[model samples]
Target chain A: MRSLFHEELETLSDELVELSRLSARALERATRALLGADLELAEQVISEDEQIDALRRDLDNRAIDAIARQQPVATDLRQLVTTLRMSADLERCGDLARHVAKLARLRYPVCAVSGELTDVFAQMSEHAQAMCLRSGEIVSAQDASGAAELQQQDDTMDRLHREVFRILLEPEWDGGTQAAIDATLLSRYYERFADHAVSVAIRVVYLVTGVWMDEQEAASRDHLGGGGVPRAGI
Target chain B: MRSLFHEELETLSDELVELSRLSARALERATRALLGADLELAEQVISEDEQIDALRRDLDNRAIDAIARQQPVATDLRQLVTTLRMSADLERCGDLARHVAKLARLRYPVCAVSGELTDVFAQMSEHAQAMCLRSGEIVSAQDASGAAELQQQDDTMDRLHREVFRILLEPEWDGGTQAAIDATLLSRYYERFADHAVSVAIRVVYLVTGVWMDEQEAASRDHLGGGGVPRAGI
Candidate 1:
């Protein structure tokens, strides 16, 4: 029975890795739809987000059932609880990706990102994907060190987020106000996508290194200044 | 012993109500800071967010302890798990409130919001505060009916969010790109603040009605069109 319970925990971990991969693929497709103006891909991504939500529901119910049946304590209970939070982060990643896709759908026939800004968004998408993928690896391998590196990964996303603003506020910006609003929100979708990945990474650190006496303690050092995309003062 | 476990669960509910109240105050003050350009109030809201984080941590630890010591199953286990999720949502409400405060601080002497849009934001802020405060009441009273009403409150916020975009995109918009960007992000912070409140209110609905077979089932109906902010197309 004890071995079965541990095995259940292991399955939960594996499923979390699966959630990461699902969100990563969704984000990749969403970015493609955004950049290429591919209406089909955008619709595909929007429709498929429900899958991530469903998988999360399954994982959550199973985790709760395990806690109920196994009566897990200490390390065991923490793992189950942490899985719930990680699943939530991954689900939000899917939602953020869907937001990206929806913007693509909303701006169909016309590319949402115009000109040199497209390159910045592509770079941000790449970095966000890497963070999401690595979060999965960190969870699967139980690598506290990889989780530490994932925390740093958000810096690139933050920089890219600020770059989106820089372009939006530039005197040469001809994209007009609608584009500016889209870019502001689109940049946030990517930035928040990375933030969710970092949230998952930190949970892994807590579970692996046992340094998380409080989630806030680990999180205090964890802000990549990603939360607020504060301009250099207007 | 079972009664003690239930009592612990009751305390978790009370604390979640407290968290909702904390975030409500934070949103109220943060909106004040944003509209008034009160640098000191912005700083105060930013600094005071830590207390919400700390309270959530305390609540999480106690819930985990309740789970570990009592080894609760069934309704007891679900209530504990829901507490954790509600605390997370309420904590995020505080963070969203802080984001609003940070934007206020970042913009400093110059008001982040400009002209007519200020009225829209004021309405959004009031609506957000109402949802959050009502979420606390719903949880404390275990009022599923009130939770239903809280979900509808998001429509006003969504309308206000779109109004922010409409103003930014209009030909008459004199606010320029920097203000456009600030308004976009600020509108999102308020919209998301209300979304988190809705998230909590739904959790209460689940626990009270036992209708939450899966969180996504209820959440599918819960979108409020708030996630994407899709435009009328470019």
Candidate 2:
């Protein structure tokens, strides 16, 4: 019976990794769609988001069923609860990716962001993908050791976010107010995507080490201070 | 034992309502701070946000412990799972509220949003508060009937969001790109805040009715179309 329950937990963790991968890839394609103005790719990301949402729902139902049947307690039960949360984070990552895709689709013939700014967005997307895939590895291996590295990666994402604001607030910004809005929203979407990945990885750390890391500080959502708001540090 | 478990469920439900109220009040105050440029009020909301976070954490821990101790199955187990999800929604509402307050604080004595836009923002805040308080009532009563009304309120928010975009995109507008970005973020925060409230209400509808409401369509998140992005509707 215990072995069967362990298998259930393992399966749950595997699905979590799969969710991470799905969300990560969604963002990557969404970025390509945004930078290259690929309407087809953008539409694809938007439609495939349903797949991620469906997987999350299925995983959540199974997690609840396992608890009901197995009557898990202590670490066993915590693991199941944690699975629900990690899936949610991944699902939200999918949503952010879809938002990116939607922005791409909204701009159609024209790329969503200004040409000069694509480099920063592309960098942000790359960091987000790396964080997401790393999160998957942490969950699958049940390893907490990768946390420090994840934090460093999150810091890099924050710096990139500030970089985005710098370019937008620069006096030479000829992108217009509309483009500024797009850049702000786009940067936020990518930053939030990376933040969710760190959240998943941090949860896994708590699940494995039982040291109880503070999840709220998973990544600094407070990192961005837009416009005249004194962008967080140079 | 069953009665005791039911009582535990009731306690969990009550705490969920408290979370709803806490989040609602936070948004109300955050809105006031934003419109009034009240740094003191903004700081209050930011500091009090931790209280909301702590309540949600405590409630979730209790719900998890209840499931472990009672070993509930069927509807009982589902109720516990729903409690966790609803708490998460309310907690996110609190985060959105804090985001509003942070925007306010970031601008100090200068209002985050300009004078003319405050009417729309205030209207959105009112809708958000109504939805939050309504969600609390729905949860406590275990009533799904309010779902329709909640949906209507969410519609109002979406309309207000579009109005913000219209104002930002106006050719006569002279608030500059920084202000446009601020307005954009502010509008998104409020719209998302109300959306979370709608999410909570819809979850209760599912819990009580067992009719399996399609929650993804709880409210249209795809409503906004910014810049040259062809705002969704007139």
Candidate 3:
């Protein structure tokens, strides 16, 4: 029974990695669609998000089942619960990618990102994709070190996001109201995509270390009797 | 033992209502800060968010404890799990409110929203607060009809969000890129706040009716062997 439970846990971990890869590819295609004004790629990304949603639903159901049947205690329980939260974060990432695709489709033929802002968006997209890929690796390998590196990548995305905003705020910006709105929303989509990736990575760190990313949070949890219900010894 | 479990469930429901009230007030104050350029009010909203976070943590811990100790099955189990999800949505609502407060602070003495956009934002804020308060009532009473009404309110919010975008994209818009960015993010914060409130209300509907908001999802779940693992009719 113990071995079977371990096998189920491994399967859950593998599914998360798969979901992460899907999210990364979706973001890649969505970015390409936005930059190149590729309506076909945008449509594909939008349609494929349903698959990501289905995968998330399946993973959630499986996690709940594992808890119900195995009655996993302590660390095992935390792992399952954390998996549910990570899947939610990844699913939201997919939704953000779809939003990008919708924007690309909306502007079709005329790139929503115009002028010098294109390069900034291109860089942001690359950073976001890299962060998603790294998150997948951390999930499959449980590599706490890789999770730390993802945070630095997220910082780069943040800087790029601010750069997009700064350009929009410049007096020389003559992209007009439509362009300003497009740039503002697009930058946010990429920034939030990176944020969700960072959130998943942080959860990974917590799962492995049993320590939250926020030091104050960790201390508070200790005061709350170890953050969750005390499980009976298996 | 059954009576004790019921008592715990009632306590969890009450906590959810309290969390909902906190979210509503946060949105109200954050909006006031944005429109009035009240830095003190904005600071208050931002600082008080930690208390909301703490309350959500406490509720989540209690729900988990109920699950582990009582081992609730079927509807009882679904209710507990759904409570956890609802708490998360409420916590995110608090975060969105904080984001609005931060925007207000970023602009300081100068209002982030200006000109005709102020009225739109003011209306959106009212809608968001109304939705949160209604969600609280629905959660406490399990008012399925009230839950349905909240969906219509969310629809109004969605319409307002689109209107904000329309005004931003107007050829005559001279709010400057900074104002445009501020309007875009602020509108989204309010829209997302409404969205989370609607989500919590829908969860209540499901908990009471076992019917998903999406009929197609319900059909799909039915095909997945009664939606979750088959409990042994405990």
Q: Go through the candidates in order and give each one's DockQ.
A: 0.60, 0.48, 0.21
For model 1, what is the error of residue B99's alpha carbon versus the real structure, in angstroms, after optimal superposition? 0.5
Candidate 2 wrong stretches, greater than 4 Å: A219-229, A232-234, B219-234
> In model 3, which regions exceed 4 Å deviation?
A215-234, B215-234
Which of 2 and 3 is the better model by DockQ?
Answer: 2
* Predicted candidate 2 versus true structure: per-residue lDDT over A1-234, tens digit per residue: 999999999899899999999999999999999999999999999899999999998999999999988999999999999999999999999999988998888877877676569899999999999999999999999889787688779889888887777787787888776777778888878888888888888888888888767665652354334222343321
| TM-score of model number 2 | 0.95
lDDT of 1 at B14: 90
Q: Which residue pairs in candidate 1 collide?
A: none
- How do the residues B68-112 of candidate 2 rate in per-residue lDDT, one tens digit apiece? 899989888889998999999998899889888988888777776
lDDT of every model, 2 decimals: 0.84, 0.84, 0.79
Provide chain B TM-scores across all predictions: 0.93, 0.94, 0.90
Please estimate how well model 2 matches the true structure, expressed as its whole-model Cα lDDT. Answer: 0.84
State the lDDT at A20 in candidate 2. 93
| Model 1: per-residue Cα lDDT over B1-234, one tens digit each | 988877887888899989988998999999899999999999999899999999999999999999999988887788889999999999988988888888888888999887999899899988998899888888888887886677678777777887887777777888888888888888888888887888888888888888853355345432314534545546
Better of 2 and 3 by lDDT: 2
